[model samples]
Target: MKTYTDTGKKDTRSGFGAGLTALGQTNPDVVALCADLTGSLKMDEFKANHPERFFQVGIAEANMMGLAAGMTIGGKIPFTGTFANFSTGRVYDQIRQSIAYSHKNVKICASHAGLTLGEDGATHQILEDIGLMKMLPGMTVINTCDFNQTKAATMAIAQHHGPVYLRFGRPKVPNFTPEDQNFEIGKAVQLQEGSDVTIVATGHLVWEALEAAKALNEESISAEVINIHTIKPLDTDAIVKSVKKTGCIVTAEEHNFLGGLGESVARELALHHPTPQEFVATNDTFGESGTPAQLMDKYGLNAAAIAAKAKKVMGRK
Candidate 1:
C-alpha cells in the first residue's frame, strides 16, 4: 500500500476560506456571501480583502441563496457560505428554482458537515446534506477529504459553470493530500492498488480508509483505496474497474448509508456489475453531543470500523 504523511492538522473550512481568498485575488467576478458565520466558516479573509464583493446575508440563509442565484444572472460567480443544514435543508426551494433548475453559476459552500460538527449536536450535524444536494439536477455535489483537496475543489468549482454543493467539516483532520494537486471533478483518485477488496471513501473518511488499508495490508489482504471527492457525478468508471478486480467493495463516509456514498456506489455497481458491498456509515441515525472522535467511533465511522467492514465484505465475496 502507498504511504501518506500528514502535512499538518487543519480544518477543511480553512481550506475553503483559503481557496476563496485566492479567487478573490485572481477572479474579479468571484463573489462570496456568508450567512452570519463568517469566522466559523473561515471566510473572514475574503470579507476583509474584498469588502465590496462580500455579502453579509446575516442569519437569513434562504435570502442568501436567493441573492447568490440572482447575482449569477448578472454573470457573477457567487459562492454562498453557510452551515450544511442551513445551506441545503433551509434553502432548498430557492436553490431548486433559482439555481439548479436555471443552471446558475452558484457555489453552495457548506461547512461543518456530518457528525464531525460535534458538540452542536444533530441540529448542526447535517448528515443528509449530501443526499439532498445530489438529488438536485445540474447540481454538482463535492465532499472533499482534507484541507488541500477542499481548497482545490473550491478553486475548481469557481471555474465550473453550474450549481455546486461543496461540503467540508469543522474539526481539524490530517491534511495528507498534496498542496499543489490538480482538482478534477468526477474523477476518483486511486490511493492504493490492490486486488482483494476495494475501499472507497470521501470527506473525513478518506483518511480513515487509508488507515484501514494499512491494517488490512498487515493482515495480508490487498485492499484498494479510492478517494471519491465528487458524490453526484461519481467516477463510475473507476468504481467499476476497481470492483471488477476486487469483486467486492467497502464504502466509507461520515453520512448515513441510506442516501449517501454507499447508496450511490451500490446503484452504480448493480447496474454495471453486481457485487458484494459493505458500508462504513451511520445506520440511518441522528448524531448527538460529543467530540468529533467520540461521535465517529460511537457511530462506527473510524478506521477500525472501516477495516472490520472491509474484512466482512471480502469474506462474502
Candidate 2:
C-alpha cells in the first residue's frame, strides 16, 4: 500500500486566493468579482493587487452572475466568488440563462461548500451545488480535494473556455498533492493501486479516502484510491478500468448521496460495468450548526466511514 503525508493543514479557500493572485500577474484578461464575501472567499490578495480588475457586487449574487456573463462577451475572463449556496442555488436562473445557455467563459468559484462550512448551518451550506451545476449544459463542475489541487484548478479554469463551477471549502485539510501539479479538468488522479476494491473520492473526502486505504491495508484489503476532482465530465474510463480490476467500488464525498459523485459513478458503472458499490455521503439530509469534525462524523463522511463502506462494498463482491 502507498502512503501519503500531510505536509501541513490549509484551507482550500486560501489556495483559491493564492491562485487568483497568480492569475492577476499572468492573465491580463482575468477579472474577479465578489458578492459581499470577499474575505471569506479568500480573494483579498487579488482584490488588493488588482483593484481595477476586481468588482465588489455587494450581496447581489444574481446580478454578479449577469455582470460576469456580460464581461465574458467583451473577452474578459471573470471569476465570480461567493458562498456555494449563494453562488449556485440563489442564482441558478441567471447562470442557466446567461452563462450556460450562451456558453460564457465565466468561472463561478464557490467557497464554504458542503457540510464543512460548519456553524454557518444548512442554509449557508450547499451540498447540492455540484448536482445543480453539473446538470447544466456546457458547465464544467470541479470539486478540488486539497489546497494544492484547488490552487491548480483555479489557475487551470482560466485557460478553459465555457462556464465552470469550481467548489472549495472553509475547513483546513491535509495538503497532500504536489504544490506545482498541473490541474487537468475531467481527469482523475489515481492515488494508489490495488485489486481488492476501488475507493473513488472527491472534494474533502479525497484525503479521507487515502486514510481509509491505509486502514484497509492493515486489514489485508488492497484498496485502489482515485481522487475525482472534477464531478461533471467525470473520468469514466479511469473508473471502469479500476472497477474491472477490483470488481467492487466505494465512493466518498461531502455532498449528499442523491446527486453527488457517488450517483455519477454509479451511472457510469451501470452503463459499462455493473459493480457492487457503497456511498459515504449525506443521505438526503440537511446539515446542522456544528464543528466541521462533528458534522463529518454525524453524517459519516470521514475516513472511518469510508473504510467501513469499502469493506461493505467488497463483501457484496
Per-residue lDDT value at 7 in model 1: 86
lDDT of 1 by residue, 1-317 (tens): 68999989999999999999999999999999999999999999999999999999899999999899899888899999999999989999999998899898999999999999999998888888898989999889999999999999999998898999999999999999999999999999999999999999999999999999999999999999999999989999999999999999999999989889999999999999999999999998999999999999899998999999999998898
Output the TM-score of candidate 2. 0.99
Give Cα-based local distance difference scores for all models: 0.94, 0.94
Clashes per prediction? Answer: 0, 0
In model 1, pairs of residues that clash are none
TM-score of 1: 0.99
**Per-model TM-score on C-alpha atoms:** 0.99, 0.99
**What is the clash count of model 1?**
0
lDDT of 2 by residue, 58-119 (tens): 99999999999999989999999999999999999999999999999999999999999999
